[model samples]
Target: MAAGRAEETTLARLPGYLTHVALSFVKPDLIYQGGLDLSATGLQYPYSGTVLKEAIALLKARQPQLRVLLSVGGATYHGWDRLDEAALARLVRDLGADGVDIDFEPTDPRCVPVDGRMRCADDALSIDIARRLRAALPRPHVISAAGWSVGAYGEGAFADAPPRSPWRGAMLALLRSPAAEGLDLVSIMSYDAGPSYRPDQAFRAYRAIWKGPLALGFAVLPPANGGPRATIESTAATLSAVLADPKAGAMLYALRDVPPGPPGPDNPDYRSLATLICVTLDKPGCDVPMP
Candidate 1:
């Protein structure tokens, strides 16, 4: 699964290896408030029917195997008690997307309610959202979540790892809960981990909790100049690790971050990374000429 934050047309521009492409976000506020905002004004990136349709159609034509999902929630929070499952279902149908991805990050300051309530801290709320989405969407649709890195839960960290926080059990609650059984993928955001850790270590931390297929999330770009991150070579190694495990998967941070040009001398890292994903995953167009 690739968290696709670029223009939908970006799908057409790249060689396709992604089994799933999650559109960056659709706002928890909209889902929780009632319905699609429709208006372009208040939203950060307003929904665009034309862009979506073109992106969906192009991807289908270019790579029939790829599944698209509307990712909801990020670093923002309004006082939405719950998501409108019916509306989400309708949107899924309208956009021809296969499913939804829950990306609620409670620890972020944005998720904190204005009233200083702990609603975002409620573990059951995340599970409830997942359950509702599973029930509302038809069968065979994908449901995934961008989960916290194991370090956030104090499970894995290196000597130089970023500041650590206790798991607080919210993320674990989602994974260990019965609701997770319906989940197709739980991508552990493995970036920003201590530099010494291997991808398998991060993968294991989540696997220990979430009883489902797991995707190790990695970053194409490092977060800061000196923090832990994967190079092109390390990324290839991680992808190989994912291939060796039956229950494992790999998720790149975003498609847009890759250089627009073909993977080559100027953009060798992106090209090599993309090639590894395409060939390793056996996606269509891998054998075709690089775009």
Candidate 2:
């Protein structure tokens, strides 16, 4: 189960709580560090030092075998331009993390290029950072990024526009870069495309451009209206359809919205969604199976 938020104070306490939750309720083999937004550095989202330390300590204590990664950048952060190789190396060394997740959205308006033409600086910064992190870290660290929807990007829409679509060509360029050589995964924000969006659309998008490991991210809340369950069924169906294609798995945008149901070793909705993939792909640790 990938956590969405982790601060310095909460990081230390997370390992134990996660372990207890996993052991007692749902045992996820992998957990993504919620995130430490770089753009939030000095803003309202000032970086949390305690969260980072506690997160590291928790991984060391409760789930050493569990893969723990740090997600850098987010919807609001766009300071990737300032991250050089040296700084990235230091970050990896200090954090003792296994990998980094880049979720920077270019359309945030805050990322507007001073000279226009959507500068490649952000992409370059990410590649350099990935290279440095891989070199400094002894273990194979992961480099992941989240992209926009295919239709939106393919159609040539503005970056911040609704559906702020993913540019397939742009993404492919990043994947092919020297720095991306160490990239282990890529998660696509498949939600909010439109009410008519289908799972096949996502599959076709990835099949057309990506040849690496992929994970689909679905939102539990509606794109415009904050509601529930709009994603669970579709997410499960999408997982069932794509599990056989070397796709890693699916991730719910959040755990908080997961519906409340039977109180056992599993939440039926989560279990069912996870089961569809495990059964189809035969992934042992994809998720904790239903009883």
Candidate 3:
């Protein structure tokens, strides 16, 4: 429901409903300058390189349960020291993406509370960059991680906020250790991190440190450096209390964003929070339209 941006192509006019389309930044200096410019990726698709793989082959020839992922350190995450790993697994196997979304927001190990709990600083190089990008792209090819909406504040009852962030626990020091078994899902950018964020307690503090599938991040603009985000009736009351647990879902930092600020409900875009996440994931169309 979230994993927004990828220019939201909205998949070119809300293609029914998205499954996973995260084509944001691949910055780490373009995976240490091994390749890609794609003739400057789209702002709103005027077309680029081989017509951008012919619009990703007309979007998997029309949403064959779309899965395109190629994001890396997007919206944040400075540098996790280094992760070349065969040039980011050869740019996710030369842009035929379906994996890699490690949005690790590292700036320099901060989160220090020590004795009272919470302590961080690279946590073993962020769990060895999620176990070296899942051993350089293995299993089904997906690795998500955009978490850090107050990295589930200092444990023990999420130890009450305010810890002077540098992405505080930085995705709770890589999904509370064991490198989160190299992830399969995690998206919690829960809007600007001010106005006291509480997207269902940042999804119950990252579902108390990763338990597989989890999304819950939404923001169709508003919060460059101004607090208070998430509207549309608090994103439908936090996606109906976090998707009523059917392996919850929702992540929208962009879907052709620009929905303005100050209680973001002027609604001129982001198709009313992607039709309120297609009527809270009842799925099927949810009145698609909006080109």
Candidate 4:
């Protein structure tokens, strides 16, 4: 669920909805708190003391089996620098979460230098944080990161093209680095691909370099250039194809955008597609049908 801080007020209302409304259709094994981007909240780094503790208590009480994770450093939290190792270790111990999700995007100005170099001093810091957290935390928790897609990363064959940008090589280097080895999953943000959004293009671009589990992240919005339904259908078809490959899975970009509303279950938005995938995937021998 891509929940906002406001939604935390109504967090209690979720379990019933999950059991009756959502689980009735799709059984979600994990629920990542849309964000804990402490940088946005004007808090200090390694937020484990008050904020993360409360988040863990609230989420764990609702569903024990549901792996609750805290997502840090989103597109907006770019100015965030290195985290103190002691503070990070404390955070990992305090939160007792299943893992953390690093979602640093390149567009964030804080990462860009006036000299045009990608300021990635924080990358090494993050990797060290993960290593310490893994050693300190009692159980082996999964660490993940959200990355931009192949077109977005501009790596492998998509290095030079209309979608290619200066940030592509830097993004690819980050993903391929040993720093990313501790990660359990790397979700690729594939929201803004052009009108001719083909999943095969993405598949071909990433298949060679990525040896780990991959998740396809996409948005439901139509293109400003005029293709709306085509974009949605293409994304769905692409995702379905990706999921057919054992190494890939589909992750809806958000949940709030696909609220249950008048458009009904057939909507191609994130929530609907997520629900559809979860239900079909959880049940084997159940026809993998999409509405």
Candidate 5:
């Protein structure tokens, strides 16, 4: 059997080869209820920090190689607009996460420029939050963020019309800031673009500005209005090529969207996907050498 296939069987049994994988638990709400951040509230999340600490301990004990991060802020997270740094740090410590993924999406009317000029308020917030989170959190903890594609600068999807950008200011500022030095990874959300969007091209564009470990982000499911769906094999191939540089990695948009099924190792769709990510397995076929 193929190496990933073999591991898949083992993972289904022992379920520990999953150590090679990383997962994110999002929006525990640092400011909710006066800083008593809970994940199971309003969001209807049965799996929140309410049981996360214990869960992390158990998972880590079994796998000893599993990695999990806490994602603060989602599509409509206003609390992140003016973050409470101390509260956020405390939450990170409490969860015992590998790091924090700032999922702050800048869409508030307030993010609009003062003079109707281009600007990304979220980008400014990203730099500040990343810097503070990096400093506040203990050493060796990851500080990562989900960013829009270079096309976020308003690259026109069609051939016609002048290209405009709303986030150009933020993008430029982030590239210029020394504060970005504290970030461990910058995963670019490369979706929501016309069919012309290429992962390799997007990777190159992000590399030009932010000189850090880059993780190419794509959707496992078909995009609603933009781009094409990527199959597991194609995603694996793309990730393999990107992983040529040890510092780079690949990220799927989310876990919530995956269809309900057996554990990742047992489910064919999840297993096939997990196989490509089982880098720590150190098994043949799992190591997708650069082509």
Candidate 6:
């Protein structure tokens, strides 16, 4: 049996609860290239920039235990090979943010079924950097990874009704690696796989090894991203079902970016979903919406 299903998650080792809802996507490439004031770009990254610091300060003020993480990638992100982990940690510290969410979406090393197992070319990079991140920012500072929907389809052990996704096993290395212990959370990018992938099932597959705070992510993305459109009803059903697990969490892909799709706007979404997550698990701080 996969450990995520069989093993009783050690609550003590994992976070007490996933407190922060994770305001995302502070583009590492831009920060790496020096983009302290993204607000200057005028409509590039509104949630980020100098305002991001204020956001963090406000979140912390609301709940001293809250952790505001700076998400670092998106669907079109690149240049994982060159990410300076040290600089990233420093940036997190500088921003007054609690930690970093390594949202890596590399194009290469797409894992393939190989020799009764799955393998990717540079799979080690995921955990290697995770370990580095954990080392750089120890306890109380959270480190999480955003996983691909069908990223854990190895033939044996890790297998769990694999979906027909563009990249299979792309994230298995990180989850299965020993370094995964260094991570505090792993949010599954459970959308964007079209009809073949079910968000709930993807969450189940990941539960096999990721015994920590495993979040089932929701997205309000554009049609250009190429996925079945998300309705509040669907998002509600998925979160309601998956969040039944005590360790399961709710994560929105973006609450700030003007997602180019209908119903992407945050009105009923922020209200309903945030309320649902709060009421369901009794997680505090849902009163203030995600930024």
RMSD of each: 6.5, 9.0, 15.1, 8.5, 7.5, 9.4
TM-score of candidate 1 versus the correct structure, residues matched by position: 0.75
Q: Which candidate tops TM-score?
A: 6
lDDT for each residue of candidate 5 in 15-38, tens digit (9 for 90 to 100): 454322333434434454433356
Q: TM-scores of the models, in the given order?
A: 0.75, 0.60, 0.34, 0.63, 0.70, 0.78
Q: Pick the candidate with the highest lDDT.
A: 3
Clashing pairs in 6: 4-207, 4-208
Whole-model Cα lDDT of every candidate shown, in order: 0.62, 0.47, 0.68, 0.47, 0.54, 0.64
Candidate 1 stretches with Cα past 4 Å from truth are 1-8, 31-47, 77-82, 108-120, 151-163, 167-170, 196-198, 258-271, 280-291
**Could you give candidate 1's per-residue lDDT for residues 46-137 as a string of tens digits?**
33554555567777777787888888776564323656777766667766778988887665422222232222356668788888889998
Give model 6's clash tally: 2
lDDT of 2 by residue, 93-206 (tens): 455655556565555222222332232434565456566556654356555666655422231233333333234334544655676566676777776666545545565565
Model 6 residue 227 distance off true place after TM-score fit, in angstroms: 4.4
Residue pairs of candidate 1 with colliding backbone atoms: none
Better of 1 and 5 by TM-score: 1
For candidate 4, the clash count comes to 0
TM-score pick, better of 3 and 6? 6
Over 4 Å off, model 4: 1-63, 84-93, 108-139, 151-155, 220-232, 258-270, 279-291
- Candidate 4 clash pair list: none
- Which stretch of 10 consecutive residues in model 2 shows the poorest summed lDDT? 20-29
Specify the poorest-scoring 10-residue window by lDDT in model 1.
109-118
* Tens digit of per-residue lDDT, candidate 3, span 53-98: 4445567777767777777776453555755656666656665667
Candidate 2 Cα misplacement greater than 4 A, ranges: 1-52, 108-139, 151-168, 225-229, 256-291
